[model samples]
Target chain A: MTTGQRIDTVFTLFVRLLLAGIFAFAAYMKLRNPAAAQAFAESIQGFKLLDPLQHHHLTVLATFAVPWLEILCAAFLILGFWTRAASFAMLGAMGVFIWAISTVIERGMNLQCGCFGEFSFPCGDTIGMCHLVRNSILAAGCLYLVIRGGGRVSIDRLLISGKPKVERLGATPTPTPTPTPSATPTRPVSSRPASDDTPIALDPVRPTPLSSSPSGVDAAQPPKPRWD
Target chain B: MRFVGRVALILILATVAATVHSLYWPIYRDLPDRQARTQRAPVTDAAAQDGSPTPTGRSELPEHYISVARAYQFWEEGMPFVDARTAAERVVGTIDGAIHLETRNFIDGSATRLLEELDRAFPVIVFCGGGECDASENVAIRLSGWGFNEIYVMHEGYDAWKDAGYPTEAVGGG
Candidate 1:
């Protein structure tokens, strides 16, 4: 209901859409051209993560799995379904990419990035900081998504019970505690605006409780589920 | 943590789904296998610089790969040289008296006239810009497909040839 909360919602929505569009385009570019798969495979060899000669099958596996994973994660991000999970997946991908590119640079290898498949940016003999900077920014965005759940427009907001209100920087003290699950099963309580009080599907967003931490501050943070 | 576990689950699910889909999707399957292409001869830089001495018995070179020195011998013998580099790349210059047939033009029928006039008995030496450039190998593959048996790929390509102080002709200058 507050102005700061409204701003947070808009910013979160913008980030999710921007990241989703970028990843979707990236996935499509790699998948559209079948020949690019080989180019991608050769680029992977430049990383020196695996010997192309000895572990050819692993190279093939990476070539197929990477772009497909991007598509899957990008789709989830777009729909705002499992937003944090998809963002985490993208973050992991960015981490791997940063490592791979740094390795090539460290070894003084001349290689085409083959990043956007056939539509890759022209990289001459040397790798530069531009690639690193781009991945870093994208990683930051994914990290933000993980910390802040998908905003008002997201499926997570519509479906998850007791979803937290968008937390604005330097906003008022934390809102009231969430009603106990048994106490209000029929009407799930949320800090969201009154206009968003419409009934949502009953299915739990996650298979298990993400965190047993009480609903004030700890619930708004990243999940800390105890593994038994 | 729950975040790590969730991410792991997404990755596992995505990998499994993609593996299954790849079996049928044209995107993941039917990728060009460059490994299946014809094997190329490996010539060390030192060896390429010091091409084998002309053998006494046979007039032709023994290996499909010829070094800078042997390439000169072929030049002295008046064997035809083909420049396999792209037109833009060729604008820098090329081997003196070498013929250029852009690899892309091979399928477009532009090289047919040149193909018909070739001397089958003598070997044709092919070279590109060199230093990880595969244009020469690709051209050699196409030449072999066309039944040109005596084909030699100049291992170090034109860069090595020019670096060795060999005769070269520029596009604009004589």
Candidate 2:
């Protein structure tokens, strides 16, 4: 790999590990014990996103489900298994957080964010613009991971080593059929365009959405030779 | 599509795991039982001491939910009331002699002093926004945990008491 490509790989790896640590710690603080879980529930109650009296079941579900989701996603992130999917899950969580924080700010309620049990930083305990900004930044990171998939060092790369994106279903390993001069017909086995200068699908199963959610990435850039 | 499938699978796995965890370690394991029971009358024994609140209490007061009429009768007997509504809701008014305690206070222990100074001599009645409100029940359970002898939840809530024209004090001119 070129020096610049190696640097990019390292940076991506760093982000993945950092986010994994953050989510793991958050899950630990919340799920440590029944008392800790209750405390976290109270923190969620502080946000008042739902009425405790009316939406009791939903609130309870959130109390239980959120931490588990965090831990599971963190685990996936750490193993670099289904890394894109894990990033998507975290992105969803961050979206909820951003929405809730904004609602709290709009209501002008002074509430403990209950985000990291009792541990809050930069923005402190009180929910405010800083919290919104922090979550937004994290959301951006998750989006980046989703777009890029796991980096060179990821288990995903190790598992899918010889293939370009995914191997075409039931297709043979053969030289590309001669290119048609008049029209560029569909090449099912082809994961990338012939030229590196042009973008292509990251995976064969899903269309690379050019305009959806900060996904403006060069799709066909060959994976920099394993970042060793 | 594959990414979406993986994401859905992760969420499903997490949700199933969480459901199991919740059953194993309930978040409300420490919560004083606040089930709605119209089973018994308010106990009058002043010396009833159950020590710190536990999930299960031997006192029938935990099962005591009184009607507004009965709550008003207690009020006439000079019983102190606890208002468990949000500060904004309480501004609409509360029972004239009610002490203010909300759910958050229980979590943070900010109302520890207030709870400490309360007169345990009389049975305390707690109320909130009447129908569809569980705040009073919640706060009452906390007070019961703190060794309050006879705790009452006014099930009809504050609106019924106010609409019935009982004594109430409005705050912030609300």
Candidate 3:
């Protein structure tokens, strides 16, 4: 890989890990303490989004479900497994937050945002434009992930085709055939590590054929005499 | 959009998971019991020692709710009116003799001393902005939590009282 490509890979990994860690920690804070969930419910109640008097069931459901969803999506993002799906889920969650906060602001309601479930480290009891801006920024990060899969060095990449290490400087191998529906399922003998154990139906990356002769010599070269 | 579709799927899956977990383990098993019940009248013997507000006047409030007319009757008889509205809302106008006790004050323990000063036997008429406004209920809950036995929430609240041309007071002279 070129130096630029390597740097890009590292940056992508950093963003992915940072976002995933934030989500996972947020989820853990809510799930760890039962009182946190209650506090979270009360915070939700303050928003009056779901009236505790009328939509008690919905309020209860949201209080319990939101954190678990965060945990699920964060785990997927961290592993780079279904990264697109996880990022999309987080984006959706951020959208809900933005809407809720907007409603509060529009109505001039003083409410505490339960964005991080029960973890209210930065935001004490105030919910305002800052909370909206924070969630919008996080949503933007998720949008980036959605657009640019999991980048390089991800479980998706590993599950797809992993390029085998080159044994010699000049040696080149023939490209593997693309898996076809009509073709018989025969395991090709390969110097590259085979993904026989992976049950997922995904295509591996194929090597491009070189124009030079396969005999480790140019077709234009003349035979050379050597004393044996 | 694909993103919207994906979010829908996540919400569905999360809802299912949460529901199953709740059904099996029950999340709110530890929440304080909210069911309302009339407590056997407070023991007078302990009230003498702790300086607790002695239950006097009426034995106990017949019901948790009282109509505006009933509240007015209580008002005429000098019952304390607790305004559950925010300070900003209170600036406009309020029932005469209403004491401002916001939900925030209750949560922060600022209202504790004030509540302690009130007589527990006298029915405290709590009212807010009325019509779908839940402040009155929330404040009433806190009053009950603070050991106030005879609590009455005015169903019509301040707005209705003002509309009816009842005696009202404002922050600044009008």
TM-score of each: 0.60, 0.58, 0.56
The pairs that clash in candidate 1 are none
Candidate 3 per-residue lDDT, tens place, B1-174, comes to: 764676677778888987875564333211121213334353356445854333333223324556787678778989899998766667788898788887566544588788878997766888987765556766775666567666667867787888877788874434
| DockQ for each numbered candidate | 0.29, 0.31, 0.25
Supply candidate 1's per-residue lDDT for A109. 57
Put down candidate 2 lDDT per residue, B18-133, tens digits, no spaces: 78887766444212333223222334544236322222343554346667887888789888888888776776888887888876676556879898887876678888887555
Residues A144-195 of candidate 1 have per-residue lDDT tens digits of 9988878778887767534333222222333344456455443323422333
Candidate 2 wrongly placed segments (more than 4 Å): A162-228, B28-44, B47-174
Q: What DockQ does model 1 achieve? A: 0.29
Off by over 4 Å in 1: A121-126, A162-228, B17-66, B69-158, B167-174
Instruction: Write model 3 residue lDDT over A96-174, tens digit each, in one string.
Output: 9899889988988765575665345665546778887878888998988887767776786666534422211223444
On the 0 to 100 scale, the lDDT of residue B12 in model 1 is 90
**Candidate 3 docking classification:** acceptable
Q: Write the per-residue lDDT of candidate 1 for residues B32-137, one digit (tens) a residue.
A: 1221233332333433476543211122333556798888988998989999776667787999989887544464457788988887656788898877655565
- Fnat per predicted structure, each in turn: 0.42, 0.61, 0.39
**Best-matching candidate per TM-score:** 1
Cα deviation at A11, candidate 1, in Å, is 1.5
